[model samples]
Target: MTPEPQAASTRADPAILSIADAIAHPVKAANFPQTILRFRNDRHAATIGLDALDDKRWCHHFGRFNPMPGNLPQPLALAYHGHQFRNYNPQIGDGRGFLFAQFRDDKGRLLDLGTKGSGQTPFSRDGDGRLTLKGAVREILATEMLETLGVHTSKTFSVIETGESLWRGDEPSPTRSAVLVRLSHSHIRFGTFQRIAFEDDAAKMHRVVRYALETLYDQQNGENDAAALLNLAVERMADLAASYMVAGFVHGVLNTDNMNITGESFDYGPWRFAPTWDPGFTAAYFDHGGLYAFARQPEAIHWNLGQLAVALRLISDAPPLIAALERFGPLYQQALVRRFCWRLGVVPQGMETDRALVGAAEALMMQGGLGIDAFFFAWMGDATPECPADQQGTEGEALWSAFGAVKAGYAPARVRTHAYWQGDAPQSMLIGEVEDIWAAIAERDDWGPLSAKVDAVRTMGEALRG
Candidate 1:
């Protein structure tokens, strides 16, 4: 039975109190004519005790940009510098988005409600500060899919379509605009530290590191200082990189600013999931060099970690920071095997055996051009003793033989109950399918397909989580 939704409450917490002034600058939201509430994430809202907000009140706070009671009085456009495609960009910051407010979830963890396409700020260069409806829809799909696949990611808390048409170079001209609110662990990024380091501000860097340790890494003993923080960041980031690889996801732009300090995946732009197991699949079209390709994600994140280590030099010695950075490779490799084994519905024998299993699985995927999601979905929980008659060829023999060696002793019955596994294909969000889903919304204002897709994806998530 569905539970009754709770009423909206703006209870305050000691979240983001210290860094508000030091890290972010005040800004205003862009006023639009209409505030059509399109989506609200009730599950995530329940976690933060915000599921009780009625449509009008929800629109007032999210759509109209009126401050939530007991939250931040004014929106804050965070300050930071980032490397865009490996080139340092000193001027970039939160151009279209801002840190709207901070609160605590029921689990006692701090979370940030940040806005995308709220309004123009000092960071807004020559371009207008707006987000297209299509972009919002895509982010919704991306977050939902990643979450279902067991990746730590930000939730798309709310999406309100602002009644305005805007022009863009990528999509059709005069695209509909909307404002999205993302609920994340923290909006502080690697670039936030980079900005302070670039200024050569040791004291400010120390303060930022301390604040981060207190807010995000509360598990720490609060004694080790900057080096401790770097170690924690590296460990979390290694887990994050492994999650992406196992989920077959490609984050198109791995900029320093996009890499969250809490190691959660957010700010999805031009992201993609591989249809087949191709190591060279690139998500963003502008990525001509394939620097952030599917196979190179671990490398990309390791590079970003090095940049974080360099930034930590503002407050700590070089040797300890380097030592922390060196842990990424081993941590990532271990996490990759664990995550892969989980997806394959098997228990890992050990590092050596797990490594061999992973290598064999990848070989099968590449050799047969197997659909990444389909392969997992089909063999989920465990493979049957007999191979399918259609797959009795040499390729099938090699694939099943490699797979049989790592099959779990016991399979969970819950995974086998899912109807998705009964089909020949799995739920996928390839680019062509995403475009088709958007077409229905744009042409006829039909939301049936999109709604159904969300339901299917959520069901998949439930199966995976089980």
Candidate 2:
């Protein structure tokens, strides 16, 4: 076996503690009956200097929720209120999770280690705090796939199967339970500000805004004011929405609480990849209104940003925040052109040509009912030689016309030489495939398939990054 990284450290820098105390509450972890190390993301762990931990130590810290040296003295469940499905709910917060620790990577970027399904807290009004093992597995798969697609997503760092059975209406009775740990830039959500605003605490709002500007947006040099933070969030969120579109992902839940101030995607629940170019595809069964549908994601993000703007009014006037909100449409349009071109493996021609090309491609996809993955996979770099027989037809001609206009002056951005490019089919994580992978683990405890899938995803990431 390869040796672990030698520079791994045991101490952590709990930066969230620097903020006000009203937003955090001390909580104790559930006493799990057993701790079986199921999955560990050593690649990401190495970045935070935690890869050297053995399974025993990993469980002690992640499973048992022990504090690392210099980390938070105890686990703290965060407080935040949000609009769940457009209904203002001030009673919600860290119901099943807490901020466990924080660390700085080798590049000096602050990263947070947070838990999910660790246990119940003051916010657990009428629910158990356990997580289904299957849920944990799905989150692992989702993060891996999103990361490979070049989306700014949280990393699923560790999962440990707790010796407990969870009962839920959605799944079969007494499903296996697990605890998950995710690595993200910040756990402070859009609702975090809303919570303080609801309390009419202007001082806390300013303090938290300054804290976010310093810890999360530190790279955004100069003018660390509320308006500047809102502008930065607008750009990041617009790009995030575009990345999800190009990746064919539906986050299922777009509540303000699920959206962090950093604009990174996390808290995956009932997320799905579109099987084809269906605009109204919905991921969650409970989304009866399809408010967060596949095609409406941009709208949902914009609406969430407006809520953030409303919260930020506690510190800044409406003019600047409204101005920041107005930029979303233009930013999203530009982001779509840029990200769509990147996925197509072509350098973007100017804005007008790129926009036309994207429009044509979308029209072709909808007209032909083409699979999202297949369309991008076949047309990457516009090589066409490897294009599937079914994807080439009269409808594609118009798309090709627009594509040619965009490609007239630019060469392909990536070569189709990677081994993954030679495969007969592209890597996809449709619900069927995800179920098959989970079925293996549920029936026979066979982890080979999951391991292989992660390896394939990382390899695909390498090819894309090249």
Candidate 3:
């Protein structure tokens, strides 16, 4: 069952406490040298009734880690094990962050306030618990862009610049430091189950499964078994993979720890949007094998789900888990067609025609080297299709035919009425633009470009939403 509607004044529910304490360790937040507020997502805050907080109180709650009313008395550094790049690691958990609080949105959906770069915990091993200010900014941009593109992503609720200088090999030494708070559906990860399974605790695993089904997921048919939970997870992740593909996003690292049970995309690390439809496009520089590249995301997610299934075998039989895992392929294909049609601003035909349309779009992008943004911007809402003159042959012909078939089935669903649509190009958050935004802040302490970019991105989202 879903959590009861939280009282207006008692919003911080802390549902995770119902689980075993062994899964989470009580921890204190780091005392930062400074607490300068960088960003607060008022729009998302309003959903959970945090929009009314003044900057001072907001900083106290987020930056200083003060407990909210009726919330957890102390923060919890959640414990779990994960497979990093397919190498199983038993010694990993929340090293720098913790679950701050839990609450229900205005719509009664349970949500969590999880932190990043907040402090060190028992899990911190040979590393200082800190986050680069540049890293927080990138997460802000990534979540904003992904949410606008119709991906189910976590909202970057707060970013506070903590007065500290952090060293990292990937970035310039002694870069600025900060903390990030993410608003997400749940922080429970696939690795959470792996941790329990590692210890062979079947009863505790069952308790976690029940907590997930009752609190996190909605059941239409009243199923409440481990297999049912696995099925729902599989379906949600399949849709997520499809959304990432349609949005041209590369999550960079699709580790089992990063794959949350709720299927919402969070934990932005070296994320990037592909400039084009290159299957081999990789976001993280460390991804030499391109394991989580643009084209391999679906397979990676499927593999992670297999790990989840393996863990679920502690409480479920192999046959049911296998059946659940098999659903990912068809579900992903369906989601791809649905999201692709939605992004194109067109009414979709039946599955066969929709798949043909998607196939043609992929072929066109690969053959012509067209950027994803340019292709989507040119084709929104039944606008005139632009085909390059050089390759008006087979690929172009297939694309135009697909467009006609789709348009003939039903009229375009989106209109260019919003002022954002009046712009010549779509808003894109490519790596070059991200670096430029960071340079403004790093060099001159200028936040004008970042603010302007966020506003433009939001406006573009509004235009797309309409």
Index of the highest-lDDT prediction: 3
Residue pairs of candidate 1 with colliding backbone atoms = 6-52, 7-52, 8-52
- Greater-lDDT candidate between 1 and 3: 3
lDDT by residue for model 3 (1-466), tens: 2233333633667889999486899999999999999999999988888887889888988999988878899999999999999999999999999999999888778999999999899999987989999999999999999999999999999999999999999999789999999999999999999999999999999888888988898553344388998999999999999999999999999999999999999999999999999999999999999999999999999999999999999988899899999999999999999999899888888789889788777866776657898888877885766556754775666666565555556568898788877778889989999999999999999999999998988888888889
lDDT string for model 1 (1-466, tens) is 2332444443545366577767788899999989999889988887778888788878888888787667788899999998888898889889999988787778778888999999899999986989999999999989999898889999999999999999999879899999999999999899999999999988888888888888887854455577888888899899999999889999999999899999999999899999878989999999999999999998998899888888888888899988999999999999999898888777677788888878877876777546788778766775554555766786866787676665544344345666666666788888898888899999998878888989999987777766
Model 3: weakest 10-residue lDDT segment is 1-10
Model 3, TM vs. native: 0.95
Off by over 4 Å in 2: 1-11, 219-224, 386-410
Q: Output the better candidate (2/3) by lDDT.
A: 3
TM-score of candidate 2 on Cα atoms, chains taken together = 0.95
lDDT of candidate 1 at residue 165, scale 0 to 100: 94
Candidate 1 segments whose C-alpha is farther than 4 A from its true place: 1-10, 219-223, 385-391, 394-396, 408-415
Clashing pairs in 2: none
lDDT of each: 0.85, 0.88, 0.90
Q: What would you estimate as the lDDT of candidate 3? A: 0.90
Quote the positional error of residue 302 for candidate 2 in Å.
Answer: 0.5
Off by over 4 Å in 3: 1-10, 219-224, 388-410
Candidate 3: Cα lDDT at 152: 97
TM-score of 1: 0.95
Residues forming the 10-long window of minimal summed lDDT in candidate 1: 1-10
